[model samples]
Target: MSGIIQLDNSDCSYIKANVSNSHNDAVAFEMKFAKDITIAQLKSKLEILTGGSASTMKVELYKGDTFVTALSNNDAKLGFYVNCDGLRLHVIDTFASFGFDSESVEKFELTNDQYEQRGDSVRNFLKQNRLGKYNDEEMQQMEAKRREHAEQMQKRAESCVLGARCQVTVAGNPTRRGTIMYNGPLEGKTGIFIGVQYDEPLGKNNGSVGGKSYFVCPPNYGGFVSPLSVEVGDFPPENFDLDDEL
Candidate 1:
């Protein structure tokens, strides 16, 4: 007796297809689909992988870069389009050309303080793993460096005397002439901050910050800066008239 069985063409159940899309043409993926599956069903499955909506997607059949027929009828079976192994199933997302994708959707984000409070955050993971700043040796080194910087800044602040004429020379800013109004530590902040009363109205505050008054000065003519950027000099105030400018 012969032990071999014969199968007909009707036994073929699935077709392997190379899938791609218009938005991303650099890569193609091979996927298998049942021959009896309808076009709408196939589109619903493709939507998860392509990030395109099934309702607005247009599927086209291809044979190794050669153009074939489009699977336009959603109710028709995939096998009706003469689907075979190694054929390409290209998807065209109608709204993709108009910048529609997952990136276009608004996303929720957490602030620094909010993220720090979450136990499942990446910062908490690093802290538990004892990596980066959580390491004992690194923490000690960071503290030493911070103290060294504080001492250097304190030494620089000793040169900035109150009521002395000085010039502020911060990087990427025009040289400004001012008088040293206050020279000490600011409230609720580290390091020495130099309070200056600028000759012109080109400052961010009126000799106050966080509702605390450090000195007396007109509005928009007081600024607080680092002592390193201040130079005690014989700088005189320059006079200007608004009508002289073009």
Candidate 2:
């Protein structure tokens, strides 16, 4: 409603398909479906230009003198909400948006190995194919595929995060260090940290005898990442060469 956020080419520092992970309030901020020129895109370009590890990232959006910090917190009120015009798009996601009157939607959480920063790959592909902007039809197609993939991954990854009687571990240990849960043997070193006691943040003074807690997942594996349902995973580069003209 805020005019599609009017996101432009130079206004972003980085827009990652990820969970905000910060619990300044009860809600987590997720940055996904990044298009346009955003902070992530800029960070990718800087990486390509400078050729180095992504440095300390401090991104902020500006309209005039004020900087936007997603949602505002009422330290006095003790709660937080997603920012207005806040957006997160996922092909494989935890939270599903069933508009109008769909109330059966269920969100799942899991922990896995950290994924690398691929926004540059995405940006490069977009630039190569001249697909920087998203039209309605394309956006719709992407959203649909995201949901589909999310469902499938949910089947695979959810086992390690949620279950009846479960044990979760990360990095080949039974210490339960991540958000993985399993109902059966993996036959390999994967899918741990399921059914662990992940923590949440409460008022500093609101801690019970148990204490406030949250998940300590590795980077890139914390936030939700989308899966592509385009099928035919073996498409050659030539098949996608004209993506710009799409």
Candidate 3:
């Protein structure tokens, strides 16, 4: 699926090139990789898709694709947004929209030894699996499982509510007030699963003095969420388009 971008204030005439229904002043999907992709080829990739030269274009960080920030105007990644959006990118220099998670980039700096060893291990694993080596039914099951696992990982990375204003005292009325949970169910309080853990899967709270476990949320500000909401990645039967009817 093309990545969903929500346009903010900038006029989007350039969208006509890479997107259909460009005249629609609403949310649209901008395909991220519909063209040939190569090693360290970010600029050509953008130019090819947006019909513009990446070097001369301005950039911005957009939520979905719009909702430009009021801060972070100097970042270079903004070019990515402009190139993908096919227009002069506007720089955002403020807090991201109230209801959106700020876009993030985490770069892992690995030692040369680590990189080489990891690459070799990956290569060996792929070679072991090879291609065209499984039966049709087995392939279907495997694909479904892979998709499920991916979905789980994505969900885990995203938390629906970053900070919930809750008051807890652990029966002793701790000195501080106002609460926000980073990773799990709080005692006597249910958590909204931005993602979930599995059956009896223990959770490590990001907060200090963490010692609480909730069963579920009851659909209220403080309701307990379902146990199934927090789950470890699992291999499940894939439901493709044909299976939608079921």
Candidate 4:
């Protein structure tokens, strides 16, 4: 007669088992536990993973789809059971079925109107503190600053003449030499933008953005920048030689 061969406990130090629980049907994970650990110790470690109390957790062993036996003896070593690698350990959390799991608990939520009416809400705090939009003086100052920024950008855009050799100097980026191809407010945008054709493939687009063609250039050789970032000058193209030594 042929039967399943079981290995000695001393042969392997640990067994890799897939863990699942009835609380969360969608979740399953694999863990490796030492064969020398007691069933109670295994359950203690599993509490952190499954959120089930170790004392009340019932662990069942399975070989593929076949049910083996319940690990009812907590004091018995995990190796004392007929388990090995690739086995499944199904944890039955009895308390979880009664809505003990946080996911299963019903949550209370407030509508926008209800939240706005609460005195302890963030909106109320901001309003009471005269912060953000609630401060009329700050709003007026912000509007003035915005208008000043727009005027400065307009001057910069006027300075960037089309077909002029220019260099882009944006913070945190390498200086890029390019020819100014277009300089104006983009379609559906508020601020002015300067379109440039880089000397090399150091750009993000082919002279187009948001389905609108601002200018025409080769692929990966065109980009748009803020008008203030472009400076019209005698910036010449840098020669790139493949055979140059480092």
Q: What is the C-alpha RMSD of each candidate to the true structure, in Å?
A: 27.3, 22.9, 23.2, 23.5
Global lDDT of each model?
0.74, 0.28, 0.32, 0.74
- Tens-place lDDT per residue, model 2, 68-154, is 233221121101111112333211112223353445656343222221234444433544454423234545654565466446644
lDDT for model 2: 0.28
95-180, model 3: which lDDT tens digit per residue?
Answer: 22355554564544655567447745433343345422123454465456546644653564353343433322121122122223
Candidate 4 residues 39-74, lDDT tens each? 999999888878788989999876545666788999
Model with the higher TM-score, candidate 1 or 2: 1
Q: Which portions of model 4 show Cα errors greater than 4 Å?
A: 1-125, 240-246
Lowest lDDT sum, 10 consecutive residues, model 3, at 168-177
Q: Which 10 consecutive residues of model 1 have the lowest summed lDDT? A: 1-10
Clash totals, every prediction: 0, 24, 25, 0
Provide the global lDDT of candidate 3 against the true structure: 0.32
Model 4 Cα displacement at 101 (Å)? Answer: 22
The segments of candidate 1 whose C-alpha lies over 4 angstroms from its true place after superposition are 1-130, 134-141, 238-246
Which pairs of residues collide in candidate 4? none
For model 1 the local lDDT of residue 163 reads 90
